[model samples]
Target: MRHVIGREEADFVFIQETKSKELSDARCFVIWGDNNVGWIHNKGDEGSGSLLSMWPKDVFEYESHVMGTGYIAVYGQHLKTSYRCVVVNVYSSCSLRGKKTLWEDISKVRQSSHVLAWCICGDFNAVRSSNERKGITDRGEQKSEVNGFNSFIDSNFLLDLPLVGKKFTWFKPDGTAKSRIDRVLVTEDWLLLWPKSKQYVLRREVSDHCALVVKSVEKDWGPKPCRTIDAWLLERGFNRMVKDK
Candidate 1:
């Protein structure tokens, strides 16, 4: 995970299925290196799921909104561009009802966020079309699930961000089955801010799911700018502003 983040030069990262109950600050440092990160995590019990969202504090200021075994939403703004957004990371369950609940939960988060711009990305654990899966015939139940997933996306007004790479994001260990169950979705408001941004599915490593990255095409015309720090929040007025919100 550390290698992928560093190589991609990502400002934000969302991870699912961490499968750990707790992660210390030191572990966060090791993963993010010198990025000055702030994070929100949902710790799961042994043999279950966990979710994590981390970003460089210098680049973005974030507040956690919702934390679930399958998802985490962070509302933040890019310090340099001052572009506001709410980013959600998801890792859904295999159970049909669980997947439906996951969709509804994310919809709630989107509706509640003050930020108009939204970006959701992660392993959905479900597909939107028959073409997304291989080595298994699409049964009636599977078709129904696809329709439900598509309806959720449509109702939320999200556009599926195109990925550059192999079609399948996940594969069985024996290579007998594959599916494009991982993806990124963004709202029209977000697309307006970064119309040229693109998402990619990197080659899979140890995990069955492939590594993903989203790169915004917003250009920097000048030198790099300054960053924010925890000290700034210590100011009398700034502290109050945070609390009042």
Candidate 2:
């Protein structure tokens, strides 16, 4: 995560796998920037779920929404994604049957009244394209799964940003190549607002799946030229003219 931050020169970062509630000290380990905000799930006895944490406190207006078992939404704001936006940190269920319920839950969030932009990202655990997979043994199930995910995105009009460096984010530790599962999906409003937004796959240090970082292209404010006038002459003439008038 720190590697990408330094390389990409990002101001605000959203991390999904902190795996802890106390992020006050962890933020320092991730990057040099100050003002961090952490939102973590309540780790119950089950010991299965994910969380969202971020830095540069000014970026996000912190809020929480509990969708279901492991799914949660940690709301944040930024110029990217939409003119008015809320970023969702999602950790979806691994089981295909469970994904059906997860999709419905996500759709409900989309249909909600004030949702201007919905940016969902995390380890989705489902592949969208046949080209995304490797050494495919079971095409039927895989095709069905991809179709389901595509239907979800199409029905919602979510835009999947083009991945930068690495093509595959997750791989079997046993030296088996597999599908690209981890992804970042944005809405039309987000793409329209920041067309240059992108996702990059980072090297895996902790888990089999690599981490993803999404960046919105910042609008450049062109260079400004300094202007100067004779301060003494301007003051004398301006005061005299004003007095006479």
Candidate 3:
């Protein structure tokens, strides 16, 4: 985690499913090694499903607004721009019914706050499209679940940030199944602060899920280059498809 943060030069970070009981201020500083940082950590049920959101105090002064079962809401003011915003870090339940209830709870938070500059990001454990999932699995993403997730986004008036670097965010241990279950969603007001922002699904490491980072691009990185996996080359007509392209 420390290496990723340093390599990415992240100013803020949200970690879900921490699977830890307590995170003291000293431990938080060790994660970032910055004394000027402020963080809010929500302990999970006995070392499982925890959450932590940290940011540079100089960049954004954050105040904890609410602490849900699997989420944390924070109201922050960007010291540089004086822009106030709300950030919700959620690690929703695997059950569809539980997720729906989580969405409803978030909607209420949105209603209570005057700030429309909101950003929600986490492991939703749900997908918006069938294309987001790959391989055989019994974790059937029901239609009602999809509709409820979409409705929550639409009704709340939030926009899903486009993902880059990878198609899937989580994969099975044996690498058979995969799904884009984690993401970052922000309101129009938040987009106004960073219209050129892009979300990148970083490669997975020890965890089953991938790490996501969203940032504004000040310089063009050029178009993404095409590359094919070695496994695909063994498939019949794979060479022909590449030649045709």
* TM-score, every prediction: 0.83, 0.73, 0.84
lDDT of model number 2: 0.64
lDDT of each: 0.79, 0.64, 0.80
lDDT (tens digit, per residue) of candidate 1 on 93-157: 88888899989888887876678888888888889988899997655579778998999999999
Query: Which window of ten consecutive residues has the lowest lDDT sum in model 1?
Result: 1-10
Per residue, candidate 3 scores C-alpha lDDT tens digits across 113-166 of 999788888888878877777885546556777788889999999999877898
Query: What is model 3's C-alpha RMSD?
Result: 9.9
Candidate ordering by lDDT (highest first): 3, 1, 2
Q: Which residues of candidate 1, in runs, are more than 4 Å off?
A: 1-8, 137-140, 218-245
Scored by TM-score, the top model is 3
Instruction: Give the per-residue lDDT of model 2 (tens digit) for 1-245.
Output: 22122124553344545555444455554543443544445342244564543434444455555546445554555523224565665666768877777788888877773756667777677888888878657746777788899999898888898899788887778757766877888887767766778887878886787878777667668998866466745675776875698
- RMSD of each predicted structure: 16.0, 10.9, 9.9
